[model samples]
Target: MSVLQRVVKPTTHKGKKILLKKEPQLIEGPKKTIFFKGRKTSDKIRHVLKDMYDLKKPDGVMLTKRNDITIFEDVTPVENFCRKHESSLFVMGSHSKKRPNNIVIGRTFNYALLDMIELNVEAYEGLKAFESSKILLGVKPCLVFNGPLWEESDELKHLKSIFIDFFHRESVNAVRLQGIEHSISFNAMPDGRICLRSYKIALKKSGCRIPRVELEEIGPRIDFTLRRTKLPTPELMKDACTKPKELRVTKKKNISTDNLGSTHGRIHMGKQNINSIQTRKMKGLKKTAQERKIERTAKRKALTESNELIKKKKVHDD
Candidate 1:
């Protein structure tokens, strides 16, 4: 009798939210972020980071600091952590005896490091709070850069630093830029301040409906608000020069200059030593004087024998 029963509806209500049975669509924007700190990382710094990013406690983004973690340790844990939590971006911090203050920021794709930037602690007073920008790529992406390899400006260096690899080989040109998926820009400021910006290239049509390629800033404008700290003695910085005792003095024991070691001052002298590149160079002085003398004598003997044969032939003919 009730083949078509009426669905329940609340009074004075528009409608109940419908839930899709399918898995959620992949996040197109900057979706997830994870933070991993070393065991030795300061609590104050962690607190500051939590406040700055407004991260929630027990979000699974804050990872437990494992012991035996070093600055030069393998990044497999980071890759695994991100993969486990489905995080796209991660900030790794470590305060080591090797590198006093260093932090590495990186992004991942399918558990592989897409890009990373390491900031060395030049000077740090105290960090109370910091600000970070949320960047996102448009639907499409393309890469763009300028300058040659050797004489590339500092700004170009900073721009190229964030990108793991853009160009296929060494050289990049307009011909090799086909099917490029990301847009990279290396131009910085006029005062030599490095401010790299990445863009996503998209096509937008005007009134005529003709598609025009456009670029929009995506993510990663890593600008650290420098916090002033009290550095150690300025006297520590001094001009390095070779002292009198630093010069290699010839000793009279049995060793000569040549027997001392490699000419390139290499401690480990072996066949595979890279300092032996000079041996591959072109040799200037070829044949020795004694070798030239012997060659001349041999040539003269051959010529004299030929002359004697010719004289005999003339005599026979006569």
Candidate 2:
């Protein structure tokens, strides 16, 4: 094969289609993740990465081999892997003297690096540390952000959204009381530290209609201090968050509802002439042709009588 042909075409049609850019879809599928490590990693980092992969479940792909790529330095390898694996989210673990037990959590947009954040794991705990039963595979997790710092600081705000996107499994309309099995809470400390905790929800029988709720710490607890953060530009963020036309709520005109739960609609019409309007056919309401003639004659006679009386008064004065 010629060099141009080899470079341009794929061996199979499926490969060719996979290489092509994806169009905007009305309904998106679950976000898949790729987990990998660097050439050098501490035991803590490995355990944390594996635990995260477990949380991601069937949608996650873990790469066993280590690579010598630094995401903040050059993101080419990460982007290539994202395209190859068709995964938008990634978690990379690396340990070094300067930043020990470090992990970078990031996501891609359109097979390109959109944003990433770096944090050092200060303390670690694995699932074995806790004795709670594990949650079901692919079960949706309820994420709770408990701290004013999440909204007060821009970096924490970004991290909060990123964490939600990473751990979110699917969109649901209504949740059952029994279906809520697990929850993940991100608590922001005052000293710029993060306490990531996982809990298993246990509903106990109660006399009332609502069941009593209990939370059990299910392991993989880790404390992280913020190190570095990178956010996408305003334009890129806006474009990334734009909703598809199919999902947009189109506004209806001239229709409204009031507080009383009644619907009202306004109708427009051209100018109306009362003279041409059709009225009730009752004799009392209708003016016949003879009645109309009589009314006009009475009005004319009254006017003439007033004129004659004025003339007589003028002649007497003269």
User: What lDDT does the true structure give each of the candidates?
Assistant: 0.47, 0.89
> What ranges in model 1 sit over 4 Å off?
1-27, 55-60, 64-67, 71-73, 122-318
TM-score of each: 0.33, 0.77
Error of 2 at 101 (Å): 0.7
Per candidate, the number of residue pairs that clash is 6, 0
TM-score for candidate 1: 0.33
Highest-scoring model, TM-score:
2
Candidate 2, residues 211-280, lDDT tens digits: the string is 9999999988999998988889989888888898889978679988899879899999999999888885
Q: What's the C-alpha lDDT at position 290 in model 2?
A: 97
What candidate 2 gets wrong by more than 4 Å, as runs, is 1-24, 255-318
